[model samples]
Target: MSGRIPHVIRRVGAVVGRLSVYVLIWAGLALLMATAVIRFYWGEITVGQMLLNLVSVETDGGGGPIVWIGVLAIGVLPLLLTVGIAALWQHVRRRERRRRGHDVRPRRSQWVKRTVATALVGAVVVGGTTAFATTVGIGDYIAAGNSKYDLGDYYVEPSVTGAEHRRNLVLIYLESGEATLADDQLFEKDAFAPLKEVTEAADGWQSVADLQQTQGGGWTMAGLTSTQCGVPLKGVGSAAGNGALHELGGEDSYLGGVTCLGDVLDEHGYRSVFLGGANASFAAKDVFLGSHGYSEVKDLSDWRAAGEPEQSFRDDWGLSDGRLMAHAKDEVDELHAEAERTGQPFNLTVLTLDTHEPVHVYDYCTVDTQNVVTSVFFCSMTQVAGFVDHMQEKGYLDDTAVVIVGDHLKHMSAGDAFHEQLDHHDNRTVFNRIWVPGEDGNSTLRPRVDQLNMYPTILEAAGMTLQDRAAGLGVSAFAPDVPAGSAQAMAPEAYADLLGSRSARFYAEAWAGGDAAR
Candidate 1:
């Protein structure tokens, strides 16, 4: 029976020894496969990327399945090694006893053998740890983990120049108003020449769009979202699913929204006005604006009341930019005059349709409809030039800050000019033009602005105190400069959260305010 027991133990020992070897090889191969996957996806994955990926700071307290798997693997390695080695040693001892019979006395050198075994195990462990650390840049990698940026620390300050009283803001968004388009010719310089002359001839302000997240193809909604949310558009699909629309609508209470901006304006005693191009019905313009505290809205149908037939039926999609501009000028004048009479300020938001699609104005244009749409863009520029010039003549320029920005990039059907101007993705470059009555000489600010920062920049210029939460992806042009790569501080998920949350809050508050008034 004793001999049989010894034989059984020996067999178990051999099996365990062989299993250990197989397990070790399996572990090594698994690690290699994982490394290969990382390399392929990242294009340049080093061991450091792997280690960094492991040290996630789980703020949500749910370590998740992946974390649990890692923890279990870490816990099992030592235990498996210890049990395998012990089984092997016991099997070898038993085999020797069975061979010599009568349990032959062990040698005094057993202590020495034990010491050597311990030393060897220690060496393997230390060597493995050192190798892992060195391959992954563990030290520097660990240091980088210390500087995590939270999405809650940003803010925007509202302070308009010379207007001690908080005033309602009117932001007019024109589509595809490239700097070149404002020029007399369809070529690049000609397109932008008028804007250049207007900005250059201004008293103290400088003009620069400082387009951000625009090295890629330009999309119109993407630009509008960036300006409205004070963050880049993220992605078109992302915008569709996320709170870019919801936040502007104020569906969530905490995330800031266009309503939040309106609320801020409301607190300063201003009403929000949203005027869409004649095609306000085409896009969900009325629904969106009405929810965002723009109680008064006038679109294409409204132009019909003024007996403007050409303006009323300009486009199947929307009104002509020329007519929209004309209406806006009249409305703004009325509002400004009313504010003057009542000791209050006004806020207005406008979306222009002149540059809508079908790149209409061709040198040898055959399509009449297309020509009107395209001509309206040029006319819109001329109109904007005249509008600013008119405001200057009326002396109201000193009291207002006029900002001309493109709502979205136009989707050209088939244009070589567009292909030449943008990348393969056809991203419309967001063109921003700002004229603050008196600060026209601030050249230091031209190169330092971004679309995401426009909200805070305007707010700061308008004299409102911005809370840290409002800082968002935008920085005040009046604020200090952040280093180039600092914008990428948050991971993609965190950034999406940052944009989504704020948008949700803005929309929720705006909707709530409108609801309360009703």
Candidate 2:
């Protein structure tokens, strides 16, 4: 009886060990498979990028049932494959033992040990490949002192000549809006016809044919920061520390070292206000804007405080773009009145949210379209155009420059149903239209322009000339020295390397120290 008990204990231990190994193998393989899925969906899958954007994913309320279904598929496929392979291997061994007339029970412990070894080896292989790929992908960016461009050479300082008359600026950032929306051939119907009409009919409005996205330029905060500051927004430390700028200790002064467009406007005695249809705290937008001299920052919370009903007009993000624009019209009137009283130029920057992911269409502002995304675009464009027309009707257009720009290219999944109705949809460009006060209705279509150039371009549109027609690594598209498709524009890859360099870290640390002092 004692000998039988010892044998039973050993058998139980072997089974437990084998099951642990199987679980580990499946987990490792599933993680690798998930990495591949993420990479396919979003071009990059770095830990830093994931951590920095995790908050936005949680707060934005963008993903729908389709996203969760995809996630489930990614998780289950690897598990099913692992289980199927293991079962087949076990069945073959069992059949061979039965044919040989050998008691498979006698060798059960040995077979369990072998299976555990094989599972461990499989896990190691999968994990090793994933690690190697991640290291190779981001190695150049993380290498110390490897910056190819000097920050000083690309810094843009607006030299406002006394002869140049400053104009009021109204910059509107459309979330995930793209030029493809206006391309009739790309969609079943034109998604941005209203916006296209506004651009085509208005003077000094040019549609940039090519607007390449740089590293950190694909996301909203990154896109906005790059366009405003002429630099990519990079994470400061480990994954755990990449939340809002306010949470980053001394690093709270967003782009403290860089001279942003808002800073220049502040220097010229312009009162700037940033109004967004999302929480400003989500991406530290308030911190960035306040640090950079935006006089007032208004967001969803402000809307609620101002007696706007939250239930009917607000979605997961905030108030609909329809409501935002409506509120903006009133705010613009008040700001303009104050400007008239004080004789100070005011910069009103409005960020629309209707076109954000999950593509929520407000019932009150619905367009006649089956596709939710298309409807969102139609409604947003109509509202924007109406706002512009209102400004024009009120004589605001005579001394004001209105610039409508897509913050980043659209980030729709490849598996989206909307992709079925497109032609040559590989290289999508962001939408950009600049309407200055006095120029003739001539379109200056540039072949390719990076987001960084927008920093100088916005200033130029506001009637401010750059000291050397360049700011940071971005040469203005309108600069005389920057000819069409010039090499003066830094490549996106090169800019990414700069962001990862030790010199960039040094600059960031210095900025943090300055913020701490203040």
Candidate 3:
């Protein structure tokens, strides 16, 4: 029995050794595919946000799954093929050795050759991937984007004024809401026309003429962080040393040390709530909101619990925008009534999920345009328009400051719908409309102001004045003039450099706390 045990152990070790080559291949291919797919969908994403999404985020049940499917195909298919070929070769070698009446064992030279080949494959994969990452600016995505200045020096503790005369805020984030798509000459149809007509400047809505999406601000989390926190979303410094992430995806309160718009409102005795069609758990939206100040969160599960029809609860990303808008209207009415009864102000933040690519076409949307995405964008607008019309009718606009803006620019990935017109388009800007009561409807905003500026702009629109019209890294577009060297006033190149920095001390304090042991 002891002799048999040794033989069994030897056999098992041999099998593991043989399988290691295929395992290595599979791992390398999987990593390559994952990086490629992530970059394709979200260009210039931070390593922190990328890792967080990998470990914590939920998929848009529709197009989001397709990306993973493609990655799996690359990872698994090549491994299967390699294993099958290796097995066949081993069988042929065994047959030949038997025919010659000799040992079937592979020669030392053959083993050496196999080891060399496997090592070469690993090198090529790792080397090629590194080259690709470098080409795409590894520093930009990694934690070394800027090394010039400490972000802590520039960060201002967020403050709010005029709490006594607070106005309800309706902040809507439109998916892929790029103003570039509005040009009829560039594209076949103006996708933003419906939204434009609904929130026309002539109708008391002020639109930002040049609402730029900041550099390294491609994904939803980045946009949300910038707009709410007035700071760009960068990852914590190396956590595991093995390149594994441990911060953003974990239970550690998201940027617990940082103060945000929600926190300010909460401190001033405002009831804050967030509503979205997708899962609140995605990208730690709940964690961020809860940590900051939101008291109520309405997401996919909430809508489902309320008995939305299965069809209306879109498999791609929970409820459709049409359905989400309907619920938002109801939520506004309920909140407005409660506010009037209690005399406490409220904030309703809504995020739309349609127009997210592999754009899911629901029953309510019509496909009149040649590009399906265009039609989808137009349909999403109709839903937003409906909510705007509702606010106007209920006279909610009288006391509510409505801000409609896109989360980020449209993705022009390889498989996305509108690359023909969207790709390499020099003119790309996020569309934004701000409607503040008792303000000039035709107010001209600071040109070239990016999404970061929206943080303070929203505060001011709600009648909360910032001492310097600045918070975090942004200046208010509503401010008469931005500080000369502030983020909003800096040149585009310099501003990108400023936000792209590692900011280890600053982020460490922001993520953990100023006094918490690192």
Model 3 per-residue lDDT tens digits across residues 1-518: 88999999999998898677656655566556555665566554456665556566466532346545654665666567567757876897687678868765677866886788778768756864674465355656554644785677777776665566678899999888888988889777888888788787787889777798976677787888889988877645533332224455656478777778888888888899999888888778888888888999889888888998988866656789999999999999999999999988999999999888767788999899888888888899999999999999999999999999899998876667667777778879999999999876877877778888888888888878787888878889877697865766767676667777777777767776452112
Q: State which candidate has the highest TM-score.
A: 3
The candidate that achieves the highest lDDT relative to the unseen native structure: 3
Native-vs-model 2 lDDT?
0.68
Question: How high is each candidate's TM-score?
Answer: 0.55, 0.76, 0.87
Candidate 1 residue lDDT tens string, 136-199 = 3455434433434322243233333333634445576766655434423433334444445575
Clash number for each model: 56, 1, 3
Cα lDDT of all candidates, in order?
0.49, 0.68, 0.78
RMSD of each: 16.7, 6.2, 4.3
lDDT of 3 at 8: 98
Report the error of model 3 at residue 278, Å. 0.8
- Model 3, global lDDT: 0.78
lDDT of 2 by residue, 265-357 (tens): 999889999988777766567767988879898887788788877553445677778888887898789888888898888899999888776
lDDT, ranked from best to worst: 3, 2, 1
Give the runs in model 1 whose Cα sits over 4 Å from its true position: 1-168, 180-189, 213-222, 231-260, 310-312, 360-376, 410-417, 424-429, 446-449, 467-470, 482-518
